[model samples]
Target: MKANVVVIQALEAQIAELDARLLQQAKLRPEYLLLKTMPGVGEVLATIIMLETGDIDRFAEVGNFASYARCVKSAHYSNGKKKGEGNAKNGNAYLIWAFIEAANFARRFSDDAKRFFEKKKAKTNSVVATKALAHKLARASYHILKEKQPFDAKRCFA
Candidate 1:
């Protein structure tokens, strides 16, 4: 038990050091500041997002960004008939994790996000609702990064 505790402490220290380094690097990027303007996106999340999504302009549209983040459903359709699923694992796994983390935080802190989450949860299960919220956040982040603008709750939650 003592050994386990010691190992956990050492790992935490290493994680803290790495997080500080990431923050230092993220400070040089404008997108980090932009992403921080959104609710639930603090230093860690903003850094993860800015680092994971390099050159937002590479995505021509929000849908493309969302798809890249794995926030959208993946399905193969042929002639309106449902076929096998698409390559759901094609996008960045880190991004999906980050967005889901942000969604969990946003629903707790932001009223707009909470309302949106509740509405979605009413229709679907909690997991789906959280994913929906993550999808919304992903799309919002795309615009925020591409346009170099702060987050607008009205525009996003509306």
Candidate 2:
């Protein structure tokens, strides 16, 4: 127990140093600011999104962005019969983690987000509910990055 605590403290100290350095060297871009306006995103999430998605114009549509971020389900259906699954590992893993983290933060911090999540959870399980919220957030982020605009909860929630 004592050794574990010592290791944990060492890791935390290293993480704090890294965070300080990133803050010093990181250039806050316009898109970074725009994405940060999102409900759950802060410095870390916004930075990861901006860095991973180098060019917002590269994605032609929100669906494409969501797919690339692994926000959407990858099931195959033919003639209204469910086929099989596609390669689920085909997209950016970091974005998936970031969006899920953002969704969790949103659920805790925003009332509207909590309601949306609850509505989804009523129909599905917890994992699906969280993913649905993550998907919604991913779509909103797509628009935010593309338009360089702040997040609009009215348009998003409605």
Candidate 3:
């Protein structure tokens, strides 16, 4: 038990050192801070989103960003009958992870977010509700990055 405790402490110390080094090395763009204005996003999530997104102008539209983030569902329809979905294994997995993490944090930390999630959860399942929230956050983040504007919870949540 003593040896295990020593090992765990050493690992934790290493992790903290690496985290500080990453913070020092990263060149945080203005958009990184703007990304944090959203309900859920913190330093880590904002950094991930900003770095992974690269240039926001590359995405022509909000839907394009959402699609790239894999927050939007792929659908296949034939004669108005739901057939199947396209390849689900497309888009940036990292962005999806970040957005989903943001959504969960938003739900836990903000009353507005919790209310919105609850409303959606009442109509749908928890997983679906969370995805919906993530989708919203992804689109909002795209606009925030593109416009170089901070997040507006009213515009985003409402």
Candidate 4:
């Protein structure tokens, strides 16, 4: 068991190293560093964001990027009744995963994030709360990339 654990740890380290190399190759190390300034976005999430988004110009708008981050509602309703579940299939899986992971991390590390999450949760469920945070992060990322500026917590949360 101990040997297996050591092997697993070694493999995880190797994967992280490779991920770093890939981030460098993509010329996104700077962007990744900028993202790391966020309360919950670390190197891993930053890398995932950069890898998943690639060229910001491809996303015509922040809404498109938010959708790609898996932040859009998956269902639609009309006249106070549920219409069929909307297709939530289109998106970047990596970005979705990264945002979810960051949301989880933020819940643990940032009181502000946790409070926002809880407020959202009181109205909806846990999944919705996480997605809401992901949406905010996606929009923040878009502006940051668009203006070539750093993330501002006040503007981001607002």
Candidate 5:
């Protein structure tokens, strides 16, 4: 039993080491670092953003990027009346997941982000609140990287 336990531990360590190597090989580049510098972002989410989005130029505008992240609401309209449910399943799933994680982190570490999240949640569900925060983060990321400027919390919140 002790030998089996040792083997299991060794396997777990190997898996972790491989994961680190894969992340390193992912090649997040510079923009990813800027994303990482955001309040809620970390290496994992940064990598996801880099791998999933590739060049930001692919998006004609930041709004396109935001839509690709699935952060925007989808509404169906027919003759000025609401139609069937619009699809909410577009863009990179990994990016969406990363943004959600970033939002959660921001809620914990950033006072402004937390306030916004709380306010949103007061009126909507927790998921909506998180999505709102994530959308803000995503938009900020696009502008900051485009302008080659560091993230500014005041401007971001404003």
Candidate 6:
């Protein structure tokens, strides 16, 4: 029991040390501060987003960025008939994870986000609603990164 407790404490200390180092590196990037302005995105998530989305200019449009983040639906259709599916797993998995995580937190903290999530939930299942919210966040983050501006809930949720 004592050895287990000691091991847990050592691991906790190592985690804290690594977190501090990550924060130090994140602070050096201006995009980190911009990303942190959004609801539900904290130090770690902002760092992940900033690192994963390197050079936002590479994306031609917000849709492109959202697609790259795996936040959009991947479906292939010809005319009015459903044919097949696109490569849904082609984008950054880490980004989808981060955005979905952020969406969950945002629904709890941001009123606009909560309202949007509930509305979407009413129309679809919880998982779809959550993914919809994540998609919104991904698109908003794309604008934030490209424009180097803070997040605006009014603009995002409107």
The parts of candidate 4 lying over 4 Å away from their true place are none
Q: Quickly count the clashes in candidate 3.
A: 0
Instruction: Report the error of model 5 at residue 37, Å.
Output: 1.2
Candidate order, TM-score descending: 2, 3, 6, 1, 5, 4
Candidate 6, backbone clash total: 0
lDDT of 2 at 149: 83
Give per-residue lDDT, candidate 5, residue 37. 74
Model 1 TM-score, 2 decimals: 0.88
Model 6 C-alpha lDDT per residue in residues 64-134, reported as the tens digit of each score: 99999999878888897889898878989999999999999999999999999999999998999999999
Q: How close is candidate 3 to the true structure, as a TM-score?
A: 0.90
- For 14-94, candidate 2 gives per-residue lDDT tens digits of 998988888678776788988988889988899988888788899999999999999987899999998999988889999
Kindly give the stretch of ten consecutive residues in candidate 6 with the minimal lDDT sum.
Answer: 23-32
Off by over 4 Å in 1: 1-14, 25-27, 78-80
Residues 23-124, candidate 4: write the lDDT tens digits.
Answer: 667656566777787778877678778777888898899988888777887677899887977678877788888877888888788877888899999999
Q: Which ten residues in a row have the lowest lDDT in candidate 3?
A: 18-27
Instruction: State residue 40's C-alpha deviation in candidate 5, in Å.
Output: 1.2
- TM-score for each prediction? 0.88, 0.90, 0.90, 0.81, 0.83, 0.89
The per-model lDDT (C-alpha) reads 0.92, 0.91, 0.92, 0.80, 0.85, 0.92
Residue-level lDDT tens digits of model 5 in 1-158: 99999999999999889779978688667787777778998777777776787777888899999999888878888899888766678677887888899999999999999999999999999999999999999898888667767678888887
Model 1, 26-121: lDDT tens digits are: 545877788998888988998889888988889989999999999998998899999989887899999999999999999999999999999999
Q: What is the lDDT of residue 32 in candidate 6?
A: 83
| lDDT comparison, 3 vs 4, better candidate | 3
Off by over 4 Å in 6: 1-12, 25-27
